[model samples]
Target: MKNILNNVVSLIVVMIVLLLIIPLSPFFLDVMIILNIAVSLIILLVSMNIKEALEFSIFPSLLLITTLYRIGINISSTRSILSNSGTAGQVIQSMGDFVLQGNVVVGVIIFLIIVLVQFLVITKGAERVAEVAARFTLDAMPGKQMAIDADLGSGLITEDEAKERRYKIQKEADFYGSMDGATKIVKGDATMSLIITAVNFLGGCVIGMVQGTMGFTEVLQVYSIATIGDGLVSQIPALLISTATGMIVTRAVAEDSLNIDVTRQFGAQPKAIMIAGGVLAILIAIPGMPKFQLAVIALTMMLGGWYLLRRMEEFSRVPEPAMAPGGGMSPTDIEQMQMEDEENFKDINSVYDLLSVEPIEMEFGYSLIPLVDEASGGRMIDRIVIFRRQYAQEMGLVIPSIRLRDSSSLNTNQYVIKIKGEEVAKGEILVDYYLALEPPNLEKEIDGIDTIEPAYGIPSKWITVDKKEMAEIYGYTVIDPLSVMLTHLSETVKKHAHELLNRPEVVRLVENMKRQAPELVEELIPQLISYGNFQKILTNLLKEGIPIKDMETIMETIVDSSMTVRDLDSITENIRVALKRTITRKFCEGNSMRVVTLDAELEKTIITSLTNGDHGVYLALSPEVMQGVITQMTEEVRKFQELGQVPIILTSQVVRVHFYRLVEQFFPDVFVLSFNEISNNIQIQAVGNIAV
Candidate 1:
């Protein structure tokens, strides 16, 4: 499991300890669950990434415990109460009974659903806000201001995909009451686990309370009430359901999100797992089951299946293609397989066209030739010039008709004139045509005006009386089709490159690598060596303190141009590297949620430049909301910084309170931005990046 998920689990275990031992009024329990539900609902107001139904575990248990505590010694009566009344007792008992059954589990499920789906991303003054929070979270650790640690995991998201993901997260935030990019600010893995455990624990307690009251507390009495075979037969469905559920959960655990509680991905969704448990509940409730038969079947199925499934899932059962219950394969996978084995070409005609000439000739961000004068530039904008008798005749005022390319407005019309191998644009004026058609002034003997016009149906040829030199017949010429297309493709690729460079995650990853990866520098040497010698591009990343393995991976990825996280899993040797223990210590000490107002003076800029002035209040979420907040925040802040504009932020102390723990735990030398109050101005300063 990831550390964030783990910590969340730990927090949940602690809360459940409270839930188990504390003897609050049923009202207090109601209130606690309600408040949590409300907060969770707030998340639903935004676009949420994970569903929260996994929380049902708490309710079932809570029901059992509550029922046991309430019924005490009345086994038969409690069972009678549960079976009748159609989910609500008469008016007198309705309120009380409903609180136990209707309110707790249902309310929590509704609320958690809200939290999981809501997104509400906020960004105005987020950097300065997150910074102060980070500092406070770090506490009074020495030299923390200079340490910096960054993970290049996000660089694994392709530029286009990152933009899309960012958009989704941001739109979710927009649905909420804030507008900062909080997706990366507060780690969410821990928060999600917390929600799950809280919900599940409450659910389990409820289930235990309700069932135990119906003689479940004296389960031995139930077998005595009926035959062993009859009791065992009653729970066959529960047996299948529990086994299937356990099988699914066991399959889904993994070890990433380092320090978070998220299990690496197994195949099952949380809902599917919970439903599996629900199936068990429904199965156990089936009527007329014999005790011994039900027990034997359920026990056999649950124990044997659990063991087999656990081994299959946790140890060796690899992810197979997704399938339907009674099918050979799913539609998506079948389509994918078909595509993978597809023929290379449907028809082969032009072999040269098949080569990737466009990508080769015009790689993204690669430069096209520079031009001093656009008129003289090598752009072959071809023009067609048709010369007929009417235009020449009109120019000369001598013949009945001669046509020319520009008899009306030659001043603005340009032409593709081939000058050597390069193409140039030049005008063909009416004056040139005029000279060609000038009437023969043989009686007067003038320049070209002395030439004779050919007779009708005669070839206008062989006017060779000029002594020194005759004017060259010039118009326009065609340019190569392939080269023109290449130039156009190059321009488009460069445009896309600029957009990619500006991406928030890409900016931070590259900057971090530039600062911290020396070995990475050596790896990239191969890419540039063929460029023969190159100018060194010094960047902020050279400061260093990053782990050698991580640095190597970053360098290798950058050099190889990797585009996805799955690619990282395949290529990086140091997969699943543990996060430093220091993060655990630091983060544990700070407040969970940190809030700050935007700088009063530049509030407009904070709003306008970052979020179009639509954002007003800024609330940074709980550090427990996620595990990798610091690294993500660094990337976002770097994106803003790359814009060459500094964002207004809250004071430094608050930043430390929220994110310092992460800094000390994860970074080698973390770079920090500190905001302070100075007269009526917010003064921001760098707390030189620190090494974690």
Candidate 2:
């Protein structure tokens, strides 16, 4: 039975092919016509009921099969009409008698109109829509795939979920592309129906006339009904399939079926319905208007609108508490309400909730509340979400949700960003103005209040909306107030990203890695290096703005280095070498890198000053030497700044950690690279040599 069910479609297709070549009795022909109508109806209903196009992924193939079956039926009916004196079957004859009713011309005109509607209107529109949908779906594949990767990187989805999403995207692309070509088949079928109708009418007339069994008028009366009936039978099913094609292509991703969606949408707008009824009622005032019919329709519409409004009111109304004998609650009801209130307040005195601090928080004043309130069209939360996803993909660390609240103590326009409940950065925004950064070469001077761009501390002005275009034309970078706040929040989070990676987050990262390389995780974690040491290494890398996305290589480096040395600094340095490609990709400009290097004398001094203590390693340089080194490093970095490039300081692997700690307090943004940490293919150009 299972095998028979599996091959039913194949058997039906073979039978359809045979129908084109073989003759059929009237009874069998009637059955096939009825089946064709049933199948078309089923296809139409299925298309309307589906939630998404991929749910009906077999629609494209089914369209071809049904079209072939339809064409085969048309052939058999044509042969029967000409061979049996304009009588194809009982179904066709009844339809002809019903439509014609002694008026052949009207029936033919109606048939032609149906065919034109299917061919010109429905089929043509669906074809264009399918073509555009296919093109857009194909064009969006890269972005969709990138989004999946971002979600996977952020640990929002597992690998299996990511694969499923990717597969669905590809399937959607293929389905639309197939639909683009399948619509053409619908168009061709419509055209073929017309041709077959003409052949049935003309061929039946000639056969009857040549037989000398009827006059011209008699032949016309007999064949005209048959032709219209055959055309209607074939074209009605074709029309249904064509409409189904339009429905599937135009259907958006919706939760409900077509009927429910349409009804609910229309019912949601009582005011529109009432206004439409009023317009129709007013139409009765115009001359030559049918007052009675318009009055009936207008009354029905007004009643429907009133009913909808009443239903909405009922749903929105809150029920009042039932009154007891003395206009107060009964004893039982009072006890129940008191018990519910107690249940709700049970957690009020919990100290654990009070002591818990958010990893990050943003507090704003009341005047800047609109920038965070979604109800007021604020996008602070949305912008933060995008920043988190992008930062996760780039840095291999997912940012925890930043808590946002309005602080009454701050200035009206001021906002503070906090990490671990301590304020780290604060900025102010003008609700009604745009910030325009000053360009180096001013094209034209514009009037506005002077300010500094909060994110980067660049000289800027808060300009009104009317001056926005003028500012842009003058080569000033304009940003809105909300964007200014979001940019500040994003930068602050990145600067303190290392502080956010607690033990739990590290455990999450480990669990995620275990899925891909379980053996490595099982072998290296805790046995070779404790979790605290592993996290310290990661935190150190992030503190210097390095991504730990290459987890496998980091683990392998740790496993190898732990056998020889037990120092965290050496293990981290070795991991950095293993991640040279990542480092180069992050900091290098193509194959060439302009950097500041330490002179041999300075390197020897730093090596001599290096000391090993309980904390691990430190540079014990004197205050005078440290100040001179900082001054010289500042001068070299300024040279790179003059040429519009970021400063990078290169040193030997042994002195890299000590030197980084020395300059970290003074030059936080400067990158310190050791020779071993840079890829060999990159050409290094020493722009300056820092020495003391």
Candidate 3:
């Protein structure tokens, strides 16, 4: 029985096709016709009850099968009717006699009307709707996927949720696209029903007359009723299915079934119902109008409307306020809410909530809240999400969720970005103004308040909306206030990203890499280096802006280096050389890299100053020599800035690490690379030589 049930659908489909070729008895034909109507009704109800279209993803295939079954039943009924002398079965005979009531012309006209309505009206509209829906769904897929990605990157959704949403999107597209073509099948079925009905009537008339078995008038009455009955039996179910097609295609993202939604929506409008009742009552004054009937309907509508209005008012009313002794209303909602909040805070377990800190946070002044509020048309959050996705793709680091809040302690235009709990960067943004950065070669001057760009410390001005275009025309880079704040936030996060790579994040990275290179992780982790040392190596690389996306190479380099050296710095340096291709792609513009190099004398001094200690390595240079080296390094870096290039200091492998640590505080933005860390295909040009 279970095996038969499992293959029931296939068995039924083959039977339906066989029914088309085999002759059916009247009783069996009636059973198939009734089942066709039942199946169509079930489809209709299911389509109406579904809240989303994907819930009925199999609807298109079901529609094709039902349509084929209906066609098969029509063929069988037509055979029974023609062969049995204008008699199919009890079902059709009963419907014919009931609808005709001895009027053949009227019954035939009604049958034609039903077929036309199904064909030209419902089926036509459903087909068009399905076509348009399929087109729009396909076009919007890329944008929807991007939104899911953005939400995932910003920590709004988990990976599993993203995959589920993407799967639903694809399923929805497939369903709609199938529906677009399936609707045409419904249209053809309606047409076929009409053609079969015509053939039955005309063929019966010709056969009865030629055989001289019945007169012309008798043939018309008998054949016309049987034809109308067969058509009605088939067309009724087709109409129901057609309406269902329209319903599913036109359905939006609804929260409830169609019946509930329609009821709730209609009940929400009492005024319209009352107005309609009034109009009906006024219509009773017309001549020859049915006054008594109109009065009953109008009174019913008016009373129902009044009852609905009272219920709506009762639900919407606020609680009565208690009176104070001073003739004032007792504590307002805000005060009540505050009291409730204080009551909750009294719980001992709630104290732990106060001690927890977000990994990344941004607090803005009250005036700047609009920049982060999506309801106010601000896209700062969206911009930040896009940056998060782009950064993760490029840097192989997932940034923690950045919390945003409004603070009353700060100035009205100021916003502060914090890592863990301490403030790292702060800036001001004028809500109604744009920040225009001054170009080095200015063509003209624009009127605005002078300021500095927070992200890069470039000279800029806060200009009103009216001056934005002019400022752009004058060779100034103009940005909105929200964008200004977003840039400041992005740069701040990038600068402190290394500090944000905590233990939990490192574990997640290792687990992610383990999926791709399981052996590498198993051999290197806890075997050659512990998790803490692995994190330290990654942090050291990130501190200098090197991407750890190629985790396999990093782990392989670590494993090889662990054989010779136990120092984390040495392992990191080896990994850097292994990631030379990624570094070259990031910093170098083309085959040739223009950089600043240390003089041979300065390089020798730096190598000599490097001393090995328990902490791995350190540079022990005198303050006098350090000061001279900084001054000369500063001058050489300035030359790169003049030429509009990032300051890169290329040195030998031994001096690169210690030299970067020596000048890191003064030149945090500068890039320090060893000759071995650069790819051999790229040519190096020494634009300036730093010497002490």
Candidate 4:
């Protein structure tokens, strides 16, 4: 029964089209005319009440269908009028007599005015709006798709939600595109109505005089009234539909309907209303004004303004309920007292919430809010998501979701990056400007605000967007604020990647490995070494910027050596030797590896200072010698950096860990590798040496 009922409208539309050829009686024609008016009114009301355009996505199709119906009605009425000389329907006769009032010229003029208004003003405006809307909606699709993907990648929204959002974007584009073409159909319908009305007047006059035995003047009078009435009946509905189309295309998405929004906005300012009332009163008091009519309108406006002000005052005077002394309260305060009672209820495990911290966080100033807001066309969050995926593939570590939020207390242009609840890096950027890095060996000076680049602290300047081309022409590296922030965030995450690894992450990594090599994981864990020791070995490698993507090699090496190696550092060294190829490839350039080697005497001294006990290996170097080693290492590292190479210190296996510990405090960015970790296939080049 429900399915049949749903198909009834389709059947009626088919019949409406068929009516273009079929003849209709006077009563049936009247009923169809009334039905057309009712449908048009309903459509207008629905268009006005909808909160969003999508809620009435089917409106374009309905517009086409209704236009067809109106044309079909015109055809049916034209057939009846020409054959019967204005005796088609009492409704048409009554309409013609009432509107024309025995004046054919006035009736025709009024009908032409209605047609001109719809075609020239309403239809043309709607068509242009629909065209522009379709173009913009289609253009915005890619950005909207990226936003959905970003939300899904960041875990801010579920997969289903992302799919739904994407579908909605596509639907919106389709709706506007259809409306663009559908508006043309409406314009064509208006043109056709004009032609049909003219045909009815001229054709009816010829038939009335030639066949109906009526004089020429009488024929003109009768046909003009009938033609104008017919045009009125059709064009009035067309005007309504056109207006509805305009409203649909121009409506902005809001929380309320059009009527409510207009009322709220217009009534928001009582002072404006009062001023308008005052101006009206002044005009009424002047001479030659309609005093009574102006006075009534002025009085109404003043009264409305006064009422609004009084209501606002009443709202302001409503006081918040305060707690009574000794927990005593009146009956009027029972609701507030009950709310307080609910607030006192606490869960037993609520304390666990305090123990959790985000692995990575970025707090941006209020000025940068648009960088993360998808609606504002900001792609920073999307770029961050892409960076996270790429960083994971390069570093072989699953970075946790970085929580982004706005900070009100920070400077408007500043942003802070944190890891494990501690601020690690912060920088300032101009939201509307671009950062242009100084080109290599360039002597030309550019006009801009001189500031250092936040990512790498290179010499850079903040330049206006219009100067971007000029900077690029000079071979300067231009980057947007979002890219600058992401670069800083990427480097900071890499530097602190070791800190992000914990027991849960370690377990997740092991579980991932078990899928590929179950026997290796089983043999390396519980039997030879504990999970905590293995995690520590991984952490130690990561601390020096090593990737553990070669899980098979690491697991096999650990399984082979864990039976004899009890110290975590010893196990780590053994694993590094097994991963010599990976480590060498990471730090070496092509077939040769450039390194800063320690002097033989200093190496021997470091080996002697290393003492092994129950706690682990410890470097017991004197303060004087440690200071000297740090000073020399800093100089060597600086030289490597100047040559555009990462600083890598190579030493023998026995003293490698101790040397790393000694230099790590002073040069945290340096890579410390043991001789055993260097692959024999790669050639070694000692670029510089550190002597103490």
Which candidate ranks first by TM-score, i.e. highest? 3
lDDT-superior candidate, 2 or 4: 2
Return the TM-score for each candidate structure.
0.16, 0.80, 0.83, 0.74
Worst 10 residues of 1 by lDDT: 143-152
TM-score of predicted structure 1: 0.16
Q: lDDT of each model, Cα atoms only? A: 0.31, 0.90, 0.89, 0.86
The reply for model 3, stretches above 4 Å from the true place, is 1-3, 80-84, 150-158, 211-213, 270-275, 305-352, 361-386, 404-418, 421-489, 513-534, 552-567, 610-628, 642-644
Please provide the root mean square deviation of candidate 3 (C-alpha atoms, Å).
4.9
lDDT, candidate 4, 1-692, per-residue tens: 99979899899888988999999999999999999999999999999999888999999999989999999999999999998886668767878888899988888888888899999999999999999999999998977787687677667899899989999999999999999999998899889999999899989988998889888889988888788888888998999999999889987557678999888877777778988998999997688999998889988998999898888788779676665676667565888668866765555356677788888999999888888777798887778777877777776787788889999989999999999888999999899999999976776777889999876778999999999998998888999988898899999998888888889888978999889988888887778878788788889888888888888888888887767867777878898888888888888888998888889998888878878787777999889888888888878877886776788999989888888887788778888888889988888889878765
Candidate 3 TM-score, true structure as reference: 0.83
Error of 4 at 517 (Å): 12
lDDT of 2 by residue, 1-692 (tens): 99999999899889999999999998999999999999999999998888788888999999999999889988998989998999899989988888999998899898999999999999999999999999999998976777676566556899999999999999999999999999999999998988889889888888999974899999998899888988888889999999999989987557677888888999999989989999999999999999999999999999999999999999999998877999898888899999988877786766456788988999999999998897898877666767887888899988987788999999999999999999999999999999999887887889999998887778899999999999999999999999999999988888899999889989989999999999999999889988898999999999999998888899999999989999899899999999999999999999999999999999999999988788777889999999999999889878976776878999999899899999989988788989999999999999889887
Q: In candidate 3, what are the lDDT values of residues 89-150, reduced to their tens digit?
A: 98899889999999998898889899999999999999999999999999989767877987
* Poorly placed runs, candidate 2 (over 4 Å): 1-4, 117-159, 262-315, 322-394, 401-418, 421-491, 515-519, 577-593, 599-620, 675-692
Query: What is the number of residue pairs that collide in model 4?
Result: 0
Which structure among the candidates has the greatest lDDT?
Answer: 2
Query: What is candidate 1's local distance difference test score?
Result: 0.31
Stretches off by above 4 angstroms in model 1 are 1-10, 13-28, 45-484, 487-692
Q: How big is the positional error of residue 491 in model 4, measured in Å on the Cα after superposition?
A: 1.9
Candidate 3 lDDT for residue 430: 91
Candidate 3 minimal-lDDT segment of 10 residues: 325-334
Model 4's TM-score against the true structure: 0.74
